[model samples]
Target: MQLKSLRMLEAVCDTGSFGAAAQLLHTVQSNVTAHVKKLEEETGAQLLERASPVHPTPAGRLLLEHARHMLRTHDLALAQLQGLDPQGASQVAGTLRIGSMETTAALRLPVLLAQLRRQHPGIDLELEAQPTAALLEALMAGRIDCAFVNGAAPHSGLQSWPVFREELVLVSGQPLTRFPTPQEFCASVFLAFRQGCSYRQRVELLMASQGVTAVRIMELGMLDTILGCVAAGMGYALLSRALVEAQQQRFGVHWISLPPGLAEEFAWVDTCFVTGSVAGWSPALRAFAQLLGIHAQAIAAGEHVRPGPAQRVHRRQAEPMPA
Candidate 1:
């Protein structure tokens, strides 16, 4: 079977959608379907299930596991070979792939890229801005070399590096004179992304533990939509402060504290989870991270912008408070 087909298979399994896999691979959906069908025929068993999107069969899963390993090994060997030619890239050549969520792409990487190009002029850096779910899939499928993502360090097969502690903020378009008590907030309209949103999960879980029932939640397809709805006085949302601030001017939203004690830990994922392989990771990622200014990088990478008690900058129409 073609390794390219296997790559397609891995992506389909990770994303659970032929169309999504094709989109991530920057190819047509029909081609992804055709490639998988061909691979299944070669394997003499069903490699993928035919359904909305798609799923991997038992045989398909096994092949995907192996394919992930093969691609990772290929990358490492390439890196080693490239390293052998260090003479040429004591100058840092070749494609550098970075994956991240939309807010991070919109907020953080501009500074990082500006400086990255200046420092690693020989490298061709490709920026892939995706949602957290898709980023995780591409990471595991070996589609991206490394990525900075938000959410809990997933309890999957990947290794996570804790980079920052992001407090969850309750965002509202209307003035929140005080942090809404859990019950009051739960009664208010809740705006969020679709089913798999991490912030949505966090808020729901918190409410569940506190015995709040029948939440008034409305789902919007995109972050911008959710924020726009909130800014137009539709509902409140929970998210990292950086994201809220990133579009604060355009969307006209502001953040208020969660009830009291609540936050989420996030990190930059270097390895793919299900693939269980770190493709060609080196000291370079960390080194490049260091080259970036910390708060600047954190904000750019869509991590919560941490402002100390003395250094806080408040954009909301209120006195500056600690971020």
Candidate 2:
């Protein structure tokens, strides 16, 4: 009946444990149990089976199916009301071009865009989704204003700020205990990305260092193709944890953290064409910064699994502008 009860039910079914659900919901186990019991009583049916991993009863299963839609609807209603409220300023509008990697476009950007749409009704946002290398190239060419790319992309004419570091996870159909060491990686058929990918080079180096010569490899330019290959039990590849985890449900794959841990560093790159406007800053930029703030907060809250880098390496700085 209540959204709180629906949320508790959803969490219980998903987590398969009262304690886990309560933890995720930031309450005690008893509170979650009480909500579940309340819902069961109201519905006049058992909502869950108290087993090792919680299994939802039939009525609960139906609610679980509808939970996502319900939650989305609730958020939408809240956002619309907030947007129209006198306390909320609603004049922000205009087209905002954002360039981002396919990976980030999948993981990070969607939530930002949704919030942006509800909060700033005037902004029309467009995306240029490409691989990291191409996106950087376009960014330098003034094709896109800003982007989040996988790996470290060096551009001579822009200022790069560390957005965050993303771990490159090795996901396969099953656990990779058989390929325990880095040496085994070289022997296995290594899946690779297009030339100029920083991750591909790291994978090669990891393989070649431990007597791994002449690795069998497959190069796929698109993320979907790469994921498809991995899901179908092809060769292994290195990819951003954010992107892989986003698609984990749709694709059946087990993850193994790479040894020494390969990681991709992201930067928010802005071009050298600074004018009087850039010096002053704009509201869209402010909104974008706000979005980045949300991102940083989410990361700090430990919503994502961040693995350490293979080794500490300084970011490449752009050339100094002529005075």
Candidate 3:
């Protein structure tokens, strides 16, 4: 089958409708239909079910997996060969799909992305904010080129670079003179991002450490909403100290520092830059990694360091936080 046909099939699977896939591929519906029909005939299987929000059949799912692999390999090879030219190396240009946690997207990415825009104007960057689990899933599915996620990479197919270390704090509506007892914690409600968030997991672990088991957690999507509810005495939340402190003035929320031991255990987390593998990195991705490496080196040398909510570094070495 032709690569164009496979691309049309992938688009249909992604968009879930022939017309929508045509729009996504910037082609007509008839072309998308013809390409899909060609694939079905070549494979001798009904690839898609005829229904609203169409779905791939069993055979289509199988071929889609291999199609994705082939497409990724082809793209990487083209990018690498283009970069071999001196002019192309300086003018690296491609769509770089990056996934990041909402917190990182808010606090960390602005300055870095600004620098990237200045250095490589040709690069088209698409940034998606999601929880760590979803970001990792997208990375493995070839939906994103790289991701900034909490903690180190978990899968053997991925490689991670420790980019930032954040100190988490316990936030509440009122000031706490001391740590709450297990009973006190159990009696309170907690607000956090949805289930896949790493910070939400930390909230559970922190409560369990206080010998509190069954805790009530309200899942919210936005950072502002969580802080707003916390300020209104809705519940407590575990968030980066820098993030909380930055918004404390507006939200009027109070954050308590965790005990040194607990801080070491659950408060410190590394925001890592994870990618599929070094071998598969595109020129644009390599350029982005180089920028991150420079920033990490600057942090290591304690030079040109901007100390504020945006660039909070708990440790100078940029090591991965304990799991």
**Which is the leading candidate under lDDT?**
3
Q: Answer with 2 or 3, whichever has the higher lDDT.
A: 3
- Candidate 3 lDDT over 114-158, as tens digits, reads 898898887889999999999999999999999999977789898
Residue-wise C-alpha lDDT for candidate 1, range 183-273, written one tens digit per residue: 7766687887666555566668766655676677898867788888999988788776666776788988888765433332221121111
> Model-by-model lDDT, in order?
0.64, 0.64, 0.84
Of 1 and 3, the candidate ahead on TM-score is 3
lDDT of 2: 0.64
When summed lDDT is taken over every stretch of 10 residues in candidate 1, the lowest stretch is 266-275
Candidate 2 C-alpha lDDT tens digits along 77-147: 55443433223545554456677656666666788788888877766888876656777777677666666
Show pairs that collide, candidate 2: 93-122, 94-122
lDDT of 1 at 223: 74
